[model samples]
Target chain A: MSSADFGALKHPFVLRALEPSDYRKGYLKLLEQLTKVGEISEEEFTARVEETRHLGDLHHAVVIEDVERLAIVASATLLVELKFIRKCGKAGHIEDVVVDSTVRGQHLGQRIVDHLTELAKQLGCYKVILDCTEANVPFYEKCGFGLKERQMARYFS
Target chain B: MSSADFGALKHPFVLRALEPSDYRKGYLKLLEQLTKVGEISEEEFTARVEETRHLGDLHHAVVIEDVERLAIVASATLLVELKFIRKCGKAGHIEDVVVDSTVRGQHLGQRIVDHLTELAKQLGCYKVILDCTEANVPFYEKCGFGLKERQMARYFS
Candidate 1:
């Protein structure tokens, strides 16, 4: 479908505050996308999704959906995590920014990022950070993120 | 001096729990190392150190010393942060895992990681995470970490 066609695909693409009902569907979608990218194993993804859903009450998620049926197209979460660096004030970490591959080249990702950035600022974060692969550096840079000297580790054992 | 000679230099290295008196010096040491690595600008470093010292009260730091003086060989912090997913749980992020260059090749880094891992377990975290550059991947792997997925992002004006 053309960009305009997809844009008019009846998805309610508005940004809204995260809700509790969004957890199960959003977490499953995130797990599917992350597993597709080799980020987590099926088993770990299942466990992690369950764990994350439990944490749903603690954080916020924003979703884009189809207006009529309200099917989710993309989603991202803003986590209010404490920072040891007091100068950071309270920090917000953006996690699980995902858009369906069918619409990859479209501007959905950027829209979600913009929404989260504004949300972080409104939440009074001194800084907002999201970690991505080396390939995605330019994408985040365009979103006003400078390169941070941070790395990620996952524990399965 | 060579690594062996440096080890034999007999500087007073004290290993103790973080104390109110230790905040200023410890914060400066952290800022110095971060600045040396260019992770933060000098101005940003100064401001952040002051801020972290206040926040450090919520976390813990272990300092090393030689004889009668603190040497600041290594430190680890337990930062309370949120992780978003379907099964949300309390998370602890480990940061500022540092060991003096003079003490490289020693097991101090591993010791710090082990200590913090235990602390995370005690803090009731479902998981503990930290990010490092490619260069430090092997070190973290050796310390019992596996790879997670790479993050992707795009920015919009």
Candidate 2:
């Protein structure tokens, strides 16, 4: 199904990219709901915004905002990458997906991921991928992604 | 161990980033050694270079060169990323690792990954990640990368 068919918020909530003003405050509340729980001070937020602004457009941080409430409710990022092996030569990796704990079960997470998946297709990516815990597999499957491979990592000091 | 102690190629082989001239011919040779097994033409390689050059320093296309033979003998790319959860606020993703089939046993792949891991550390990344097939797991383990997690993926058409 097209992204439009994917369930989206109604009424006063809107889904869009974060603005400069969001860097000062508000996003931290929504960020706390992600798998990583924390409070990011405004200074760090501001720095990250500038660093990303300079890095250009490959990183898209999609935010679900409650227009009337003036708060971010849900969010995810689509990281597009150029590749050497894919038949289409590009790939999109979605990361840090989350829905506000207070707003779970509303299907906002599905809408946000669907939007990014459509964007990835439009950008000619051979694949749109994300790594989620086994518990979250069913959620991604709901968003039209099928489970395929395993993930590996190494942490450094 | 420091990146310098990472067992680099001996004799006339040197490791470094790909040069502009590499887009014309030698990269295809080096690419063949990667598990993907294919030839990338000059036009495609040039276009990809232009596309990613705008992505800035994150994509380090490190290559092993033979000063005496004047050819790229091995190659790999390290993609560094910023994050919200890590203590260091960044991550390193290694991709497209290749070691010339002719020079495969010399530990060129190990040095290339080691260099990128150190580069990632210097860039303040808290972890380094890469997805390889089950067969290649032992090779990455030799480079100080242990099996920690499974990498799951979903492919889109």
Predicted structure with the largest TM-score when compared to the true one: 2
Per-residue lDDT of B29-114 in model 2, one digit per residue for the tens? 56755545356666777777676666656776677888787888888888777766643177788888887788777778888888
lDDT of 2 by residue, A1-157 (tens): 1233333569666887766677544676667666454566667777776776565456777788877878788888777777776431777888778788877888888889988888778767777888777788888888888766456677875
Residue B135 displacement (Å), model 2: 2.2
Query: Which residue pairs in candidate 2 collide?
Result: A149-B152, A150-B150, A150-B151, A150-B152, A151-B150, A151-B151, A151-B152
lDDT of 1 at A136: 80
Cα lDDT of model 1 by residue, B56-111, tens digit: 32255554544454446666665655444423444566766777677778777776
Q: Give fnat for candidates 1, 2 and onward, in order.
A: 0.24, 0.42
What value does the lDDT take at residue A147 in candidate 2? 69
Instruction: Return the interface RMSD of model 2.
Output: 3.2
lDDT of 1: 0.57
Clashes of each: 35, 7
lDDT of 1 by residue, A1-157 (tens): 0011123223456555444455434445654675333333456545644544454433566677645545566778776554334444456678778887766777788888876776666666666777787788888888777775555564432
